[model samples]
Target: MEQAKDLLAKGVLKPGDYAYHEGLSDWTPLLEVIVANSEPEASPTPSVGPSLSTAPTPKAKSNATLVVGIVVGLMVLGGLAAAGGWYFFLRDEPMELVKTTPPLKVNVPPNKEVEKILAREIGIWKITGHRLPVIDPETGGPGKAEDIRDTIETRWKEKGKSTVSTFSPVINGKKVSFVGYKEYDAKDGVFIWRVKGEGLPETVSKERYDPVTKTFHGEVNYQNNTRELSTFRRINKDRVHFKSKLFDADNKLLGTSEMLFTRLEKKEPDQPPMTAGSLTAKEAAEVMAWVIGKWETKGKGMPVGGEPQAIEITMEARWKEEGKSVEFKYTMEEGGKTVSYFGHQQYDEARGIFINRSKWGDNPETTSHERYDPATRTSRAQSMPVSPAVGSKTTTVTKRIGQDKTQQTLEVYQDGQLVYSHEIVSTRIGRYVEPARPEPAPHAPQNGLVAYYPFNGNARDEAGHGHDGTVIGARLTADRHDRADSAYQFKLGDHIRIKGLMGKPKNVTLAAWVKLNGQQGRSGADIISIGTSVNIRVDSKSGTGGSSRTGRGSWLGTNAKVNYTDTGWHQIVFTFNDNTDRQVVYVDGTSMAASRNQIPIFYEGRETDTVVGINGRERNAGFETQGVIDDIRVYDRTLSAAEVKALFHSE
Candidate 1:
C-alpha cells in the first residue's frame, strides 16, 4: 500500500486512471501507455527474500491521504477538459440546416398580355401567382427563397391566381415530392393551366396541384424542425376560387379546402319634361259692366203715385257701362213696405241684343226680352208670366229715344186672344227736366260755435255759451258789464227789443246771462228785441201790470212769467213750441217754468233792425244788470232741458 501510494504520488496508479481488467482481476489503465526501454544489461539479479513479490507495506495515513488528494485533483482536471471540448465543438452548432432555394418560374403571360386577356375574358380565368426564375430549372442553385416567395406573392396578387398547392408522391421507387398547381385567371383568357414542381416534398413539402400556377399554395409542416410553408392562389376571373391544404410533420395531409370569392356588379340612374290656362281682360270687363246704374219703377201707393198700397222700385247703379253694353238694376217697395223684386237690363253691341230679367217673390220666369229696333228707335221683345201655361204676349218695347220716344203698352193674351190691354207711356216727353233756377244748398246749424263777444270775463254769465267768452273794450268799465243777448233784436228808438228773424223763427231758443240791479217800474223796457217788433223784458218793480213782474214776453204782449233776482250773474234759457202752445224757461241748469197758458204765437209782421249795447232808450234802458255779464248763444230750434245743461258745462 505504501508503494502504491508512492506510485500514485508520482502519477502512476490513481484509482480512476486505470480500470480493473475483468478477466485478470487486475487494474489497467484504459489508455494505451508507451514505454521507452534502454538496452537491457545482460545480467539480472534475484532478490533474496522468499521470492514472493514483496508485499506492499501498509501506507501511512498521511501518504494515503496525499495519494487520494492527488487522485481527486486529476479527476477534476479531466472533467474540465471534457467540458471545454463540448463547449468549443458542439454548444453553438446550428440545430437546423435550411436550404434557401430559388423561386420557381411560372410559364405565364406578361401583365400586359394578361390585361388584354382579362378584357376579353370578362368572367373567368384568374391568375394566381408568377415570378422570374431565380434558379435554372435544370440546375438547383442557392438564392433568397423569401425574396423569391415575396415576388411570387406579388405576382399572384396582380394576376389573381387560384388553387395552387404542394404535393408528395412516390416516383421511381424513391420518395419524391413536388409543388403542383393550376391557375384560372383572366390572364389565360378563361382557361386553367396545370403546373407541377420537382424535388420539393423531401427537403420541403407542397400541398396539391392547383392546375393553374406552379406553386405550393398551402401550409406544410416538416418533421425535422423545418419552417412551415403556406401559399395562396386565386382561380376565377370575375370571381375568385382558391385551394389550400395543411400537411403534418410526416408530410401527411392534414386538411384541404376550396374557397371562393366573387366580384360585384354596378347599377344604372333616374330622369321628368318642361310647359299649362286664365281670364282675359276683355271678358272680365264685360262681366263687371252689368252691375252699375240707377233704375226706378212705380206701382200703386209708391212715392210717385198716391195709393196706400203702392209699390215703388228705385235702383242706383254706377260706373258699370262698357263699350256697346249697359246694365241697370232696381229695388222694389210695395205699400210703403218692401217686397222681393229684382230687375236687370243688359244691352250688348250697340243695342244689337237686349236682355231684360225681372224676378219677384219666387217668380223667376216673369222675365222678358227685347231686341234692338233701329227703325222705331226702340227695343221690342215678348213677355210671359212665371207660369209657362200662361200665354205669351208680344210687342214689349223699350224706347231708345229721349223725351218723345215710342212708349211701351202691355196687352195680355190668352190662347192667342187678347184678354186685357193697359196703355201706359213708359217714356214721356220731358220726363226728366232741369229747373230754370238751381235750388240753394241746405244750411246746417253751427252747433259747436264758441261765443264771440261781450267784454265781461265772468264765467257764470258765460255758462250757456259752450265756451268762455272774450273780453273787449266797452262803454262801461271792463270789470262792470252786461251779458250779451243771443236773441235777435229790433230797437224802439234806442231800446233793444227781442224779435223774430228770417228762416223759420217759429222754433226758437233764447239763451242769455243776466243780473238784475233794482226792482224798477217801467214799460216796454227791453232786455232783448227783434228789430223793435218783439221783446223779452224783465219787470222787476211790480209783479203784474206795473212792469215789476219778472217774465218773458212776445211782441203781442203774450208773456210767460219767471222769477228773477238782484244778486249775481245767472244763465237764462227760454224755449218755445209754437205748434204745441208750450213754453219753458231754465235758470242755470234747472227748469224755472214750463207753462201752457202763455203760448208762443208766431209773429207775422217784420220788425225793425237789431241793436246792441243798449235799447232804443239809450238814456235809461239797457240791461238793469249791475254786475258783470258775459256769453250768450241762440238757436233756431227748441232745445231740451238736458241740452241746455250740457251746453253750460261743456267747456
Candidate 2:
C-alpha cells in the first residue's frame, strides 16, 4: 500500500492507466485504476520503520522519485510510439488481411466443341448403256424397245466407215435423229462408238467429234471416249438419260454408257471438302510393302533403249505426305542429280476406286486410276489427257506386273503420234532410308546487300549530263574506281530514276564513289535522300536552321565534318534497315561517328531529295572535288561490318 501510494503520489498513473487484466490488454478508465488502487491500499499497511523520522525530508525523496518516474514513463511512451509506427506504417501488412478475390474462372471450349461438323454424302456411279428403241412414224412416238434393236444393228453396218451412226426416231410427236460415233483407238484396232436418236440432243458437236479432239479433251479410255460424245434426252423436262455403246474400229463391242441424270436442286454453296480419316499405320505398312524390293523398267522411256536398265526409286510414305492423304514418293537419279516425283493415291474403299494423282517436272494435271489386276499382279492404270497447249499430246501410263510391282512406264502421244517415253523404276526397301540431304549454300550475312549494275558504260543524268560532262565531272574523282558511276551520272532534269533492276526491296543499301569538290568549309548539304524530299543531308554546319547552304559544308553539315570530301575517290556505303531504330554509314568500311538522325530529312533545302554532287537547289557550291567515279551498287539488305569491309577493298 505504501509503495502504491508513493507511486500514485508521483503521478505515474495517467487517466487511461488500469490494473493489468489477463484477458483484455486494452487500457481501462482511470476510475477503474483508482478503485483497484484504493482496494490495495486498504488491504495492507505493515508498520515498518520508526527510525525513519530522522531520514531526509520525505518531500525531497518523493520529488526525486517523481522525477525518475516521469523519466521512465516518457521513455516507455517513446518506445511504444516507435514500435507502433513500425508495425502500422513502416512494415508491410499481413497478406491475409489484404482483400483480394480469386481470379475469375475462364471457360475455354474444346477445339472440337467449337468446330461445327457438317455431314455430306456424295453419290457416284459407273453407267453403261447398250440398247436402243424403235420409233413409230404415224404417232411420232417411240415404238417397241425390242424392235429398235435390229435398226440399231443395221445402222451400225451402214455407217461403219464413217465415225458416226444415226437412227431416226419419233418421240413426243417430234422426229429426232440419234447419232453416235467412235472416238478412241483401242488396242484391238477398235474404237468405241456412241449412238443417240429421238429426243436426244447432239451433245458432241462436229468440232469435238474427231479422235484428236477427243484426246485433246482428256478422255481416259475408249469407253469414256465414246460416252463423252453421247447425248442425253430430256425426259419429262426434269430427268435426263443417255445410252451408248463403245466399239472398236472393227466394230467390236467394248463397253457402254447407260447414264442416268437428275437436275441438281439449288442448294447452299458447297464448302471445302473435309478429310474424314487418314491412312492407319497398318494400311501404310501394306501400301509400302508392294513398293519394297528392287525393280527395273524396260521400254523406250527406260534409261537403256528398250532394255531393262538398272534404276532405283525408293518409295517413302510417311508424315511428309501433304494434306490428309498419304503420298507415294519415287525418288531416283535422273541425269546426274536425284529427282523425285510423287504419285498420291487416295483409296476410298467406300468409293471403290483409287484416285491416283501424279506430277512430273512442270506438267499439268495428269491423273490415272489404280485397279488391282490379280492376273498381272499389278494395277492397270491410264494417264488422263494432257492439255493441248502442252504440245497437243496424250500420255499413257501402265504399271507393269512383277514381284516388286514398282516399275511403271509412260508413253506420250501427240495427235496419235508417239512422242517420248519415260520409265520410272521404284523399289521398296524394308528399312526406311531417308533421302540424302543436299549440302546447304554458304550463309549470307544478315546485313549484307548486293547490287548488280546492268547498264552499259553510257548512262546520262536527268539534266542531260553525260559521263564526261558536268554531272559526272562534278561528283566523281579523277580515278574512277566504282565502275557503275564512272560512265554515268543521273542529271537533274531527267526527272526519272529507273532502277537498273526490277523487284521490290525489303531493305536497301546505297553505294557510290563520290568526289565532292564543291564549296569548302560549309555544312548541312546533301548528296542523296531516299524516303521523302527532306530526309537526308550530305554536309552542313550544326545550328544552321532554315536557309542553309546547298552544297558541301553547309548548315546540313554537322560537327564541321565533310562527308563529301572534295579530294580523292572515296566509296560511301549507306545501309538502311526498315525494321530497326538505326541506320549506318560506312566510309570505306569504317563506321563514322554521327548523331542519331531520322532518315530522309525532308525539306527544300534540308537534303530530302535524291541529289548527286549537289543539294536540292541544283547549285554545286562546295569545293568541287573532281575525280572519276565508278562501280555504284545497291542491295536489298543491310551489309554487315565484314561485308562493308569487303566492298571497300573489292577491286
Candidate 3:
C-alpha cells in the first residue's frame, strides 16, 4: 500500500490499474472505488518531500454502510450475469453487444484472411483433372468442363481488391470466358466472389476458409432460385481440388460437380523454352495462343455422313507443352459419326516458316512448312498430305469482317492441277458447351495371370512363362501410379516385340493401359499388332475406334455416342472366346464397339510373333501408337464380363 501510494503520488500509477478484487473471477477497472479512496494532494512547492496530513479524516457509520451495500450489489450482479452467459450458451442465437463505429484509419490492410487466399492464388491454375457432372439442360445449372483445358488466373485490382479471369482453350487459340472479383464488406464478416459487370447487378458468393482442413466453401446468394455451393481444397502447394453442389432456392439439394487443378508455373513471357531456335519457345507459344480460339463455318455447310447437306466444322486450339506448341482438334460429322483431326504446329526461325503436322483417318500426316507475311497478313504453304506423291500449295487470306465474324479465302493446287477452292467465312465462338462426365475406368485383373509385362525397370516378363518382350525404341516414363514407376512410352517409330507370345491361339484375352499422346494418326493407332497372318489389330480410324473382336462396330458403346480414343490411360481388353465364336472389347472397363472374327489367331512369322505400336504388312499403314502403355497382360483364356469389371475396379 505504501509503495502504491508513492507511485500514485509520483503520477506513475493510474486509478484503472487496480482492476482486480480478492474474490472476483473477472477483471474490471476499479475506477470509481480507486478515485474515491485516493486523497487529493496539494500543488507541489519547491520542496521535494511530501507533506503529511496532521488531522485524521473521520467517516460516518451511515456512509460506511452505504459503501458496503453498493459493493454487495455489484457482486450479486456479476454472479447473475456469469450464470446467464452459461445458460444461453447452447442457444444458436449470438449474444448482442453494444456496437460502436470504428475510427477511420489512413493506411491499414483489410482482412488478412483474404490476403492469405490471394497469396495462394496469384498465378494461373488450369483444370487438368476433373469429375464434374453433366448439367440438366432444363435446369440451367453448372456443368462439366467445356473446353478440355479450363483455367483461371487471379490478379490484384487494388489493395484489398482482386480480380479473377476464367479461360478456355480452343484448337488453336484461347479466350476469356468469365471475369469476376473477390470482394468483402467492410462492416460485416461476409466475404464474396462478386461478379458485377456488363448489364446485370452484382452476383456475390459468401466465402469462408478453414485453416485446419485447408478447405474453402461458399454459396452464391441471390434473390433468384440459384443456390450454388462451391468448395476448394488445397491438395498440395501446386494443386487444388474443387467441388460444387447445387441447391434450389428453398435450400433443397439438387446435384454436384468436381474438378482438379494444377497451378501453371510462371515464366518470362518473352523467353523461349529452348535456347537454340529461330523462334523461341515463348514466341512460338505466343503465336499459338493467338490461334487457339474456336472457329465455326458460316451459314454454309458441307456433306456429312454421306449426306449431301452441309455440316458445320468446328476447330478448337489449345496450348500443348512437349515441343512448346499449340494443338488443334477439328471435329465434323462424317459417315454418321463424329470425326476429329488432331494436329500440332510449331515455328522454325531458320526456315522462316511454321510447320504443322496433322493426322486423321487413313490420310498420311501432312507437314506444312508455311510462312506468315505480316504485310499481307496471309498464310501460305506448299506441302503434300502424302510425301513425294502429289505436291500441293495452299494460300489463305483471313480478314476480320466484324467483332465476331471472320472471312477467309483459300486456294489450293495439287501438283500442277488446280483444285476447286473458294472463299469461306467463319464466326468466332466464345466459351464452350459443357461436357458430360466421362465413363469410369475398369478395375485391375487379378489371378489367372499368364503373361504379365509390367514394363517396370525392364521389359522382363513377370508371368513366369518366360515370354519376355524385347523393347526397341520405346523409352521408360512415369507410370499412372507414381513418377518412380515405369511404363513404355512409344512415339514415332518406337515398338515392342514378343516372339511366340501370341500366335495361333484358340482363345486369348489381352488387356493393357494406354495413354495416347497423339490419338489421331495416319490410318489408325494400333495398340497391338499381330504380324503373323490375318492382319488384326485394335486400332482407331479417325476417331471411330473399333476392335476386330466386335464385328463391324463404331467407337460408341452398345448405347449412345462415345469416342474411345480420348487422350488418357484407358484399360483396353480384347476378349476372344473361340468356343462361343464371340469377342468383346472393353475400354476403361466399359464395353466399346468391337468386331467379330471367329477365325483363331494365326501368324506366318515364328510362333508367338506379337508386336506393339505398329502392325506389320500395312494393317494400319504404320500408324504407330504415339503414347505410353503399361501393365500389359495376355491371358490364354477369356474373362467373363463380370470378371473383367471386377478387374477394372480392383485396379
Candidate 4:
C-alpha cells in the first residue's frame, strides 16, 4: 500500500490500471478504492494530487453490486479502447498482421476464371484422330467407325480478355461454318458455351473445369430436343482428347464419338504443303477451283454392246459443301434421248487422295480414287466394280490443258485385257478476252461476193445487189470497235427481214461478226435463218456455232468446237461445196467443225425470205439471237479457208 501510494503520488501508476488481492471479489481501479477509503486532507499544494476529503465518499449499500457494476462497465470501456487501438495499429503495420493471421479463401472473378481456361485453347487445332459408334448389322451391336480430318481456330477477342472459336469441318473446308463463344455468369457461378453453325441448331452447354485433373465437363442442350454429355481432357500443351455421348429423350444412350486434337503449326499461304499427309481441305479446293464452269466434251469410243460412234458430252461443275467439293452434272445425247449422270469429287485428307463418286439413274454408285500431281496439274484415277463378280475396271488421266480446256484419257479393261479407250477434249464456253486486233484493210475477196449488209448505221446491202433488209424490234448499238450505232443488238422477237436472199445456190458461204450476251434458248439463238431451208445459229447446249437445214434438231446439225457464243466479239463463217457435198464451219479464222457427204440444205429449192437474229418460221419465239450482230455477208460460191480468214480479219 505504501509503495502504491508513492507510485500514485509520482504519477507512475494510472487510474485505469487495476489492483487485485486475495480479499478482493474482482479487480478494481485504485482510484475508486483510494477515494472510498480516504478522507479529505488539506494540503498547501492541492493541485499536485486528486482532491480528497476527511469524510468517506458515500457508497452503495450493496458493495458487491457496486463491484459488479464497475467490473462490467470497465470491460465495456476496455473493448472499445482495444478496438480503436487495433485499428490504428493495423494501419501502421498491415503486412505484420497478415503474416500472423490465418488466411481466408475467396473465389476469383468470373471473367478471370474464364480467361484462365481459354488461354490454353488460343491456337489452331486439327482433328488428328476420331472414332464413332456404328451399328453392326450382323450382331445388332455397336462397332468402330473410321476417322476423319477437321480444323478449328480459337482466337482472343475483346481486347484479349475474351475468346471466340471457329470451326471449318470437312463438309465445308473453304468456309468457317461453325462459330462458338464461351461466357461466364458471375451471379450463377457457371460457365456457358453457345455454339451455332450453318444448317445446325444453336446449342448451349453448361460446363465446369476441374483443375486437379485438367479436364472440362459439360452438359449440352440442343434446342431442347436432344442432350449430350461432353468431356475434354487436356493431355499437354499441344494435345487434347474430347469425347461426347449423346442421349435420347428417355435418357437412353444412343451414340458416342471421340476425337483427338493436336495443335497445328501455321504455314505461309503461298507455300506448298510439306507432305500429302498435311494437305488441308482449303488448299485442295483451291487447286480444283479452275474446274467450276460449263464444258463441252467430244470423243469417240465403242460401247459395251454397240458399234463405235462419236460421243458428245456436256458437263457442268459447281461448288458444293461450301467449296469443299465439286459437284458435276453430265448429259449425253444418244439415240434421240438425253442420258444424265450426277457426280461429285472431294479431297480425302486422311488418304491423301481425291474421291469421285457418280450415280446414273438407279444404277449402283461408282467410286474412284485419284492421285493428283500439283506440278503438272494432272490427276490419275482408277475405278473397279463394287462386286467382285465383275472383272471390269477403268483407269483415267485428266490434265488441265489451259485455263479454259482439259483433256481426259480413259481406258477400260475386262479380265485383264484392254477392251476400249477414249480421248475426250473439254472446252470452256468463254474467252479470257476478245483481244483487240487491227482490222484488215478493206480489200475482201470479191470473186464470189453476192450480198452484204455492213450494218454501218443502216441495213442496206453494201454489195448493191438490192437485198435491202428491214429491221424490226432490233436496236442499234456500238460495234466491236466501240463506234456508236454501228451494230445491232437483238432481243426476243427482234429480227431483220431481207429480200431476195434464200435461193438455192451451187456453193455458198455465210459469215458474220457476233458478240454473244450469254447462253440462249434451248433451240438455240439464230444469227440468220430461212424457212426450213438453211440456218446459222448458236448451239445453246455447247455455246458453239452450228449450221444445218432450218428446223433441224441439234442432233442433225454440224456443231463446232470453237465457242463463238462467248462473252466477246468473234467472227463466224460457214462454207459449203455442193460438188463434194462437204461443209465447213470456222470461228475466228480457225476451222472448228467439218462434215462430208451430208444432205444439203435448200435441196428442195425453196425461196423463203432470209431473217436475221431469229428463225423465220419461229418469229417472236424464244429463239432470238440474244446477242449483237454486225457486218453480215453472203457469197454465191464456197469461200476458201484463206478467204474466210481474210473475212474475219476484215472486222
Candidate 5:
C-alpha cells in the first residue's frame, strides 16, 4: 500500500489505472485502494495495572537495561542494510523521496502516428501551381506573380531519440537557399518547425495534424509580430496542396498564396537522356535569349471576303529548366475576338532541328520544326495542321532586326500552291540590353611598357603612367584565368577613353587580349585607336584585323577573321618599327601581316584622346566593339617575337 501511494504521487502510475499486490484477489482501481485503510493499526492492547513499588530489585533492573540495548543495536543494523539496498537497486528507478516530489519524465517510444505523418511528406516535390495574381479592383487588371517556382526536397533524420526532418527549396541560377527542421512534441500533440536561410528571418512555427483528413494546420510567426495561417493537405500519395494567408501585426489580412506540389517520379536506369540538335538543352535555350521578352505586333490579317482584317498579337517568353527549354504565351485579337495560345520550344537532337509545340483552347495541338541561324537571327518553321483532314501546312519565316524588333511572315500552302500570306512586325515591349560576360584576366611582362590597363574593376593605368581611362556602360567580369572582376566586358556603345600621349613615339607596339562576341561581323569595329592617325581595327569589308592611317589606308592587314565564330580568347599585337620600315600584325603570337615598305605612323599635335573599343575620331555604332577587351598595353618600342609569344602564353 505504501509503495502504491509513492508510485501514484510521482505520476509513475495513474490513479485510475488498475494495480495488483500480493494480497489482492485481482487488480483493483488504484484510486479505490489508495483511499482504503492502510493495514489498520493493531488493536490497542488491554490496559495493564500500574506497578505499586517505586524501586525494583538490582537483578530486575539489569534485565530491563539489557533488553533496551538489544533493540537499539538491531535498529542500527537494519538502517545500514536499507541504505545499501537503495544505493544498489532503487537509484535508477523513479521514486518519491518526499511528499513534494516532482512528476517523473516518461521515455516512451515515439508513437506510430508521427512516423506515418513524416512518411507522407518525405519525398521530392515539384511545384505544379504558382501563386495566383492579385486583381486590382479599380482597373480589373491582375498584378505580377510572386515566388515564381522551385523544386523542394525534404527528408527525415534522427537526432538522438527524436526525429528531425530537413527541408530545402532550390531555385536554379540563384545563390540563396532555405533550410528548415521539424520535430514532434508528443506532450503538446504538435509539430514544430524552425527555419532560417540567407536573406530570410528565422521562424518557429507549430502545427497540428488531423489524421482523418490528412491535413496540417499551423501558424507561422515572422518578424515584426506578423503571422501567417497555413494549411497543408495530402491529396494522394504523390500530391499535396498548400494554402497560406498572411496577417499584419495588427491582425489585418494582407495576402494569400496557394500551391500544389507533385512528387517527382524516380527515373529509370535505362532511360535515354534528353537532348536536341547539336546543342544541349542549356545551349539550345540560350540561343533564344534574343526573343525572351514581351513583344507586340499589329498587322492586317489575310484577306477575308475581299477585305483584310485588323489583327493584334502579343507574346511573352521565359526560360525554363535552367535553359533546357523555352516556354512562350501569346494572345491574338482578330475581328474583335481574342484567342490565346501557349507553346513550348526545344531543340531536337535526333531531328537536328528546333521543335515547337503549341496548343489553344479546345483546339488540336500543332507541332513545328524550325531551322534557326544564330548568325542571321532568323528561323524558318513548317507547322503541321491541327487536323490532317482540315487544314493546310503553314510556313513561318521570322527575322530578328537589331535587338528590339522582329519581322514574321506566314504563308499557307494547299495542293502545292501558295494560298494566303500574312506579315507581322513585332516590337519589343522595352529597350533591349545585350549581355556581356567577363573573361579571365591574362598576364604580361611590364618591360618597356608605356601604359597598361588591367581593367581590374576600374580603368586606372598600372604602368607608372597617369593615363587612367574613363569607362562608359561597361561591366567588370572574370578574366581568362577565371578571376572575378579582373576584366571588362564591352557591349554596344561601351568604351574606355584615356588621355593621349604628348608626342608620338618613333616605334610603337599595341597589344590587348580580346574575346569577340557572336554578333561581330566581318567589318568596321575598332579595338584601339590613337587619334585618327594610328588605329588597330577590323577592316571595313573582311572582318580581318589591321592597323591603318588616314591617307595611307591600312598599313598592315592580318587577313584573319576576328575569332567571333571560334568563341575563344586571343591576343592581338601590332608593332611598328620605324628604323626597319616594318609594320607587323600578330594574332596569337604568329605574324599574320607585315609590311616592309610602310611609312612611319604620324600623330598630329591636336590628336584626340586614346580610345579603346571604338574609333577615337568616330564614335558611331559602326565602329563599336562587339566583344570583351582586357590587359591592354602600349609600348614606345616594338616587342620581339619571343616577347610576343610570352605575352600570349602568360595566362
Candidate 6:
C-alpha cells in the first residue's frame, strides 16, 4: 500500500502498465485510471523526451477507464449474488420440521408405610409410672420406690419433613425436659431418634416399626453409660401402651417403668396427606448404620449377692464404605488398669449376617459373626479367638425388643458346660467424631511418649500429641550447656500446671531432671501434683511423715528423704503401675520408697490434672519448689524399671 501511494504521489504511473484499487477485481491501464482519478486543479503533466512512454488522448483514456469500472462492478455483484444465494437458500434439504417435546415426569414419593406410622403417632400422651429397686443408702437395703408422671407430646411439622417428640418427666420434684426428633436418615437408610435436654447426656435411639403388630420399639442409649429397652404400642387411636426397662452397663436391671398413655390432643396435618411406605430391601437388610456411635455400659448396680463389681466398658462405632460397615473401638478402665481394643464391624447384607472382629495389644484376634433372623428380630453370633487361641467358641444372642432397644447375652461354653456369661442391654448414644489424621512424622519414636514438654524456653509439646503444659510461675533459666533459657526456675510461688492426661487406666511414667536449692523446709516441697481442681491430688510430699503418706487425704509422696535439695540437677521419675497397685518414686533414676494408694493413681479425665512445683498450693502456704526443672515427659503406658532408667540416661 505504501509503494502504490508513493508511485501515485510521484507521478510514476506507467501508460500501458495495469493499475487497480482495493476491492476492484479487474485492473485498468495506468494512464487511463490516473486521468480519471486526478484532481481537477492538479498540475498538468510535463512532456517527457522521445524515450519516455506515453498514452493516447485524454478522451480515449476516459472511455477505457469507464469500461474497466463497469467490468469490476459486474464481478463484485456476481460474487455477492453467489454468497447470498448459498446462505439464504442452499444449506437446507426439503425435509419436514419438528418441534421439541417436554421432559418426562416420574413420581418419587415417600414410603407409604412409614408415613402411616408417623400419622398414627402424632398426638400428645400423658403417662404415670414408678421407678423401682432403689437402693437404701442408710439401711443398705431396698429404698422406697419413686413414682413419677411424664408427658410425651409429638407433632409433625415442616410438611412431613420430621416428627418432633418432647419428653417431660416429673421425678423427685424435678422436671426433666427432653426434645427428640424422629426422622428418616437418608445417609443411614433408617429412622433415628435423637433427644437433647438440660442435665441429660445426648441420646440416640434406633427405631423399628412392625406393621402387623401395630407396635414400635427402640433401644435408647444415653452417652453416660445408661441404656433402656422401650416399646410403644398404639392400643387404639385414643391411647398407647408404653413400657421401658432401664439397665446399667454390667447388665444389672435398675428398674422398670410401664405407662398406659391416654391421647390428650391431636392436630390435623395440612395439604395432600402424607402416606406410609416400607423400606427398601437393602435398608431392611442392614443394621450397621443404626449402631454407628459411642456406646457405654452404666457402671451401676451389680450381681445381687456377689463380688465382681460392675464393670463399665465404653465402646465406639464409626462407619465406613458409604455406611456399609463400621470400625469399632472400646476401652475398659477398672481396678487401676485399662484395656483397649480395635476392630472392624461389617455386615453381609446378602446373607443377613454381621461380624465384630477385634484385636487388642499382643492378644489374639477374636472374630464374632452373627446371623440375624429377621422374623424373630434376633441374632446369634459365635466368637472364636485365634493366636493366644482360646479354643472355646462363645455364643451371643441379641434380641431386639422394640424399634429402639436391644438386649444381648453372651454364654461361654467350655467342654460342654457354660463357664461364663456376660449380658448387656446397650443403646445407641452419640455420633462419632471424625478421627484426626496424624502428622507424617512423629518427634520421637521412643516407646509411649504421650506428652513431652522440652522446656526449650517455652512449654510446647514437642511430642505433637497436643498435651502442652502451662508454666504457672516459672522463669526460663540457663541449662548446663549454658543454653540460655532452656530450663525453668521456680522461686516462692513459681510453679507449672499440666492438665491431667492420666484419665484412663494405664501404667504411666513422669520423668524430669530437677535441681532444688538447699533451703530449710524446701526439703519436702512438691515437685509435682496430679489431681482435678479437687480430687486425685497426688501431692509429691517429701518421703517424711506417715500423715503425709496416709491421712492427708491426698496421694502424697515426698523427697521425704531422697534429698533432692542437695542443690544439684537430678533425674526424678514417678512410676505408677495400675496393675501393681502402687506409685513408685525415683531420684536420679534410682527407685525410692513405694506407696499403696487408697485408689489407684489414675486421674480424672478433666482439666487441672497436674500441678508442678507446688503441693496443692496456688498461693502462699503450700510447699513450692525453689529449684530448676527440665525435660518433662509423660507416658500413657507403664515403663519398666529398666525403661525408666533408659529414658533418664537418654537425656
> What is the C-alpha local distance difference test score of each model?
0.33, 0.33, 0.48, 0.57, 0.55, 0.49
| Winner of 4 and 6 under lDDT | 4
How many residue pairs of model 4 clash at the backbone?
Answer: 5
Candidate 3: where is the Cα deviation over 4 Å? 1-448, 532-539, 542-566, 594-596, 605-608, 618-621
**TM-score for each candidate, following the candidate numbering:** 0.23, 0.26, 0.30, 0.31, 0.32, 0.29
* lDDT by residue (tens digit), candidate 3, 1-651: 344434434555433232232343222222222332343222221111001111234323232222221111111001011111111101122222212112112122357766665566655666543222223222334332322235554544333345333222221132212234565555554445543221112233445555666655454433334344455668887887555543445555433334456768542111111112235555555555566678797443222233334437788766544345666767888889876666667776544457776756555566555555444434554444534332344445555554556676555554334553555677768643323322223454545556777765456566666666666667666788854326877876677787764534567677777777655356556666544332223344433332332222212211113444445667777776768866667767777655455555443443246677775433445566778888777766778888777767765
Q: Over the stretch 1-651, how does candidate 6's per-residue lDDT look in tens digits?
A: 334334534545323233445343233333334344433222222111111011222222232222221111111001111011001101111211111111112122257655765666676666544333323223435433444344555666332556755443332234433445566654544456554433323334554555565655445443334444545567888776554444455655544444456667676321111122223446533566666778765433334344545657788877544455666667787458775555666665444456566655445556665666666767667665543322244677777877546787776644334556767777656777865432322332367777676666456567776665666557667665556557888876777776554343356666777777745233355655544222111123445211122223344443335354665777677766667766766665567666665445424333445666675445424466677777776676667777766665666
**Which runs of model 5 end up more than 4 angstroms from their true locations?**
1-445, 550-558, 561-566
**Over the full model, what C-alpha lDDT does candidate 6 score relative to the true structure?**
0.49
- Scored by lDDT, the top model is 4
* lDDT, candidate 1, 296-318, per-residue tens: 44433222223344334455433
Q: What is the lDDT of candidate 1?
A: 0.33
lDDT of 4 by residue, 149-223 (tens): 566656543312555554434331232234555655566544555544333333344555666676665554433
User: In model 2, which runs have C-alpha deviations exceeding 4 angstroms?
Assistant: 1-319, 322-365, 369-378, 389-426, 435-440, 445-651
Model 5 local distance difference test score: 0.55
Sorted on TM-score, highest at the top, how do the candidates line up?
5, 4, 3, 6, 2, 1
lDDT order of candidates, best first? 4, 5, 6, 3, 2, 1
Compare candidates 1 and 6 on lDDT and give the better one.
6
